[model samples]
Structure formats: structure tokens, C-alpha cells
Target: MTIEPYQWAVRCPETEAKLAIRGLSKTFGTGAEAVHALVPLDLMVADGDFLCVVGPSGCGKTTLLNLVAGFETPSTGTVRLDGKDISGPGAERGVVFQQGALFNWMNVLENVAFGPRACGESKALAHRKALATLDMVGLKDFALKYPYQLSGGMQQRVGIARALTNDPQVLLMDEPFAALDQQTRETLLAEIRQLWQRTGKTILWITHSIEEALFLATHIVVMSPRPGRVRAAFRSRFNESKDPLITVAPDFVEAKRQIIHLLGQDANKEEV
Candidate 1:
């Protein structure tokens, strides 16, 4: 008897799954007064997949993110990475919040080195790794600056560098650029796309901006309101488009229109 590689993967998920959420759900409080945050949902984030999640308010997008990050436990089902059940936050996954959550007291170099240091890395080695990661994010020269001294975009770069310094298998970004100006957001979006291309890291990002998702995501998932469920999912080619003005292209515009329609339907449903 001969076994094929793909067949073996079915039997050995640990070798195949980068992150997997199976029938996961979340609810806050208890009984009739409880708030149902997420309906049972299944999602598989394959190796190196850049997945962007978009949804209406109260659709549990952030809850889903937190579940996968292990900051919040699912009320039902499970989240797994490399086939191991996720119980809590671990170095295997790195999260970037909406604002640059940097320690104001720490210099840029210290902030970037913080993760490695927490993981028991020697000071010399951690600082060296931090320098390399900072350079990757184009912030090596800002090492001596404090968080308040840097621009909003620069601080976000430090946040990204800090996450990368840990060498996590996956990145969980929750609207990391939501607070930035439009021009800065676009610039950071392009940089993030390039970084993904260079690193091949699996990412699960939550965002309200459809354009941002269209520009950066290889795959996009749209969720319904309240107890959120997947309303639609798309594998997009716009990210592959070389045009800088891809957002205005016919195909991109059409795709964006369809997503807006879905969101509109959810909004209508919520009102009723």
C-alpha cells in the first residue's frame, strides 16, 4: 500500500494546520441576559495565508481574533495551531492592537527587545535581534527615541517590529492602522504587504476598511452582525495587481461594491 502526502496530512493535522478554529463560539455573561458574541464558526488559516476579516459593528470580529490569540476562551469548540489546542496566549502568535501599545517609558530599542527578553533571551542577543527587526521595519535609526517622540506611523512601525522580534509563527493584527491618517495608512498598508511577501508569515487581521482589505488581503472574510457568522468569503487577485490605483480599477470597484452590499444587508437586518 502506498500513501500520498496529501492523504497523510488528513491524518496528521499538526504538520498541516497553521491555525484552525473549529465550531468556535463566544458568549459573555450567562442565561437570557448573556450577550452572544460569536455564533459557532469554523475557519482554517493555512500556512502563509494573509486573511483579512471585515464585518459590521457587533459582529464579533474582534472576539474571534481574541479567541484565536487565546486572550479570550471560546464558550464552545476549539482553536488550534499546528493541531495543538490553544489554551492561552503564547509566543507562537503575536498581536498588534489598534493603537501602538508601546510602553511610553521605554525607548524604541527596549520596546522591540521586550518580547525576546521576556522569553529568557540574553540581553546582548535580544538587543541584537531587536536591531535587526527594527531595520526590517525601517526604524533602526530611531532606536534612541521614545514613543511620544515618534510620529503615529513610526510608533506603529515599532509595534510591528516588536511583534516580529519574537519570531512568531502567526501575526494577529486588530485594526493596527485604524488611528492613522489616510496617507499614513496607505503607506503602512503597502509596507505590510511587502513584509508579508518577504516573510511569508500567516496573518489574521481585523479591519473596518474594505479598501484596506482589498489592497492587502489574499483572502477576505465578511461576517454578519451580532452573533457573527461568515456571510461571504473571497479569494482576491487585487493584491496581485501591480497598479498603484488598483482601488479605482473596474474589478476592484466591483468587488468593493459587492462587499458593501453584503454589509448593507447585515445593517438592514440589524434594524429589523
Candidate 2:
């Protein structure tokens, strides 16, 4: 697929949006004690688009994600998936958390198969699906190994495989690679880019790393500090590049610089 260059404000047509956030806001508590975690914000994610969200700490990035995941109710407005309002969690969305969150007692295969089994698939069918998904993540050989037996990166891959076994339309990932070493994180970033291309799944990813966001996202949304809102949104093509050195390319560097500048402005405002 030929990705277009970055545009400062690229809007996905309403008809093409797989996930739509309209006037979504989240406030904790009531009255004077209320803490606005997210300000009313709108975003549209086109089908098969890899959208990464980045912002300062306490910027409500996770709050926005939770609303879409239907884990929390928005204080105002709604999140719609394929034109249907999201009332609560459903099978259509698969979430990968910061940690593996795998069942410690289950081996890799069992861990990955748990989702399918829960959805009423037969034990045999669930195992088959899990094995295939594990193979997709290059973990077929480690299927029998326990989570504690695997490295942190391998554990994360298992989490991803588990998420894919359900064949979800959208993948919601919250800093899935944040705990890994630099090298492992880079490798997984490349693998994830390939996985997204192959699966063509719409992804809503939350991250603190600007470079990771720039490299993995087809569209990047930078949010403002506290009561977070969209500070800037850009359509980027860097995710299309297969070259390992693409991150160091002049354009990629410049894009990173621009995002840094935007975050710097937020940082200054945060200090005041």
C-alpha cells in the first residue's frame, strides 16, 4: 500500500471510520471534587489504520482508550464502532495491556487458547486457533513453555497472539512493548508493523515514545496535558517503510522533531 505523506490535519471520512469518538469526555468523582481526566474530544479511525496516541503523563490518553474499549463510561458523548455506539466491551475489540496479563498457571498454548475457549469454541478448535496465532508471532516452539519460562518480550508476544486468536476487528494496545529492552522493543516494533500490514486490523495504540508512535502509526494523535484533548493529529507514512534505518531518515527525524516541539509546548504549559 502506498501511504500518503504526513498531513497536519487528516480527517477520516465519516463513512470510512471504523472507530469514531464524538465529544467523548471522562470525569472522575462529582461536583467540586471532580477530576476531568479527558476533555471532550473527537477522533475518527479509518478501517485498517494503525493509529497511535501520544501525550504527556496524566494527559488522559489511557482514559480515551478505556472509553473506546468500553471499560469505562464517558462522562459525555459516545464512542461508536462501525456506526454502533459502544455500550460495553465486546468480542470485536481485542486489548493487549502493558503487562502480559497471561494466566500464570497456563502454558503458552493454553494461555493463548483461553480467549477462544471462553467464546464457546471447543477445546480442540481453541487449541488449533491458538497454535496458528502463536505461529504467526513466531512462538509455536514455545507454546508448551510457561509464562515464567519465557522472557518479557516472549511473554508480550504471547499476549498479542492471544489477542489475535479472536480475529478482532480492532486491536487496542496499551504500551505493550514499554517494559522490554531497547533491542527487544525495536524488534517487536518491526514485527508489529508487519502484523498490522498482514492482518489489516484497525489499531488504537497508546504510547509514551514519540519514535515508536511515528514508526508504527499511520495516523498519530498528540494530546494535551491533563483534561486532555487533541493537540495535533497527523497522517504519517513512516510505518510503510520496510527499511530498518527508516527512523534515521531525514524526514522521520524532522517529524520526530516536530512532535517533540509540540510536547515541549505542552510541558511548558503544564509547569505554569
Candidate 3:
């Protein structure tokens, strides 16, 4: 794969931002029927930052992510990547949805390789990249298996692998582990952490689990109930620690409690 000069240039530590969302807001429909999904919100994502967004059910957490991924256009404001306006989806940003949207007709390797090949990589090179990525997600042995043959967690792994095959600078994950059992979710969490450390990719993750956000994010943002706006933003150091017992640490517990309290306050407002 030929890496463009700009792609290599972006990896420079001196670069200030990987993504910039300025007064971004989204609304669906028109007139009285208009449904405002996101209020004007501004955010800057530094290179290699793991940003996790959490909020109540209608708080537009996924809407925010979709904007960054260019899956939806913002009704107001702009989203820029490396200083350029993002008008549509590109290989620079890869996305992993809540469920693995794999093609049942294709085997695991083919599914993962589909992206690279679609991007014009030679079949052999794409297959090689796909296999390497499968190995990263710990699914190398299942390369030939079809989607139906794998469990839910395994399918999600393939979804992750497919996204990685593009070597995207940014990863937008929308509750990728939400469908899994607790055990499988925890396992995938560790793998995702390792992958982030290894690749240093910029990630925007949307999850409902505060514990999961604290465990994975370098930065966290909590949105208000609806017409979602950032109610709070925090920088967390817990994810940097290697201690297995860190989750039980007082600081971690306090942070989680604080976030839960914040969410609860907003939820109460919605009820009122």
C-alpha cells in the first residue's frame, strides 16, 4: 500500500489536531416536525486521543459520532480532519457499527479484505493485510469461517479487523461491544486497548457504559439528555495505568460515581 505524503505528514507529533468539530449541530426534517438531534457543540480531538462519548438514550451520542464519520452532514457548523472540512466518508476514517454488518456470503477473510480491495489494493495485498489484521484481533484461525459460523463477539472482532484493514487514522466505533456477553465484552476491551496502544490511532467511541468509558478513554464527554450538548468533559488517567486493580482504586470509583450522578441529574430533568 502506497502511503500518501500527507498521510505520513499527519503522523508528525507536532500536528495539533486529528479532528475538529466546531459548533456542530444536526436536525432532521423541517418546520414543526423538525427533530433536533444535536445542539451546537465544539470539540477538538488531538492525535492518538481515545475519546469516549456517553449520554442518556436520546442524548445524540451516536449522532455525534456519525457526524465525525461523515455518515451524516451537520445542519450547522463544520467537522474538519487535519484542518480540512469533512464532507463525506473517506478511508481516513473507519467505522465499526454496533453490530457486525458482515456479508453472509463472504468468508471472514473476504469480509475483512473487502475494504482494501474496494480501495483498489491488489487482491493478494488486500488478503495479506486482512490476515494480519485478523491476527491483531485474535481471529486469524477463523479466517475461512463464514459470518454464520462465528459467535456474536467473534463477528464484532471481524468488524474491527475490517475497519483496521484500511489503516485509517481515525476509528469511529458505535457501541461495537454492546451486543456481547459480559465475559466477551471484557476480553474485547483488553484487545481494543492493546490495539490502540500499538497503532496510536485517533478513536471516537460511543458507549452507554460509564465503566467501559473510564476503562478505555483518555478523554470523556457526557452529553445532556436531548438536543444533545456536552454537559461535561474530563481527562482521565486511569486508562494509562497497567494495574489490573486500577478499577477498584478510589479515584476510579469516584470518577464513575461523579459521571453517574451527572447523568442522573439530567435524566431527572427529562422526567420533570
Candidate number with greatest TM-score: 2
Badly placed stretches (over 4 Å) of model 2 are 1-11
Better of 1 and 2 by TM-score: 2
8-119, model 2: which lDDT tens digit per residue?
3256755668998888899999999999999888888888989999998899988888888899998999899999999999889999999999999999999999999999
Model 1 residue pairs with clashes = none
TM per candidate? 0.94, 0.96, 0.93
- Ordered by TM-score, highest first, the candidates read 2, 1, 3
Score residue 183 of candidate 2 by CA lDDT. Answer: 98
In candidate 3, the residue pairs with backbone N, CA or C atoms under 3 Å apart (3 or more residues apart, or in different chains) clash, namely none
Q: Give all candidate RMSDs, comma-separated.
A: 5.2, 2.1, 6.3
TM-score of 3: 0.93
Q: Residues 1-272, candidate 3, lDDT per residue (tens digit)?
A: 01011121243332467788888999999999999999898887888999899998988999998889888999999999998999999999999999999999999999999999999999999999999999998999999999999999999999999999999999999999998999999989988988999999999999999999889998888889889998988777777888787778887888898899989999888789
TM-score of 1: 0.94
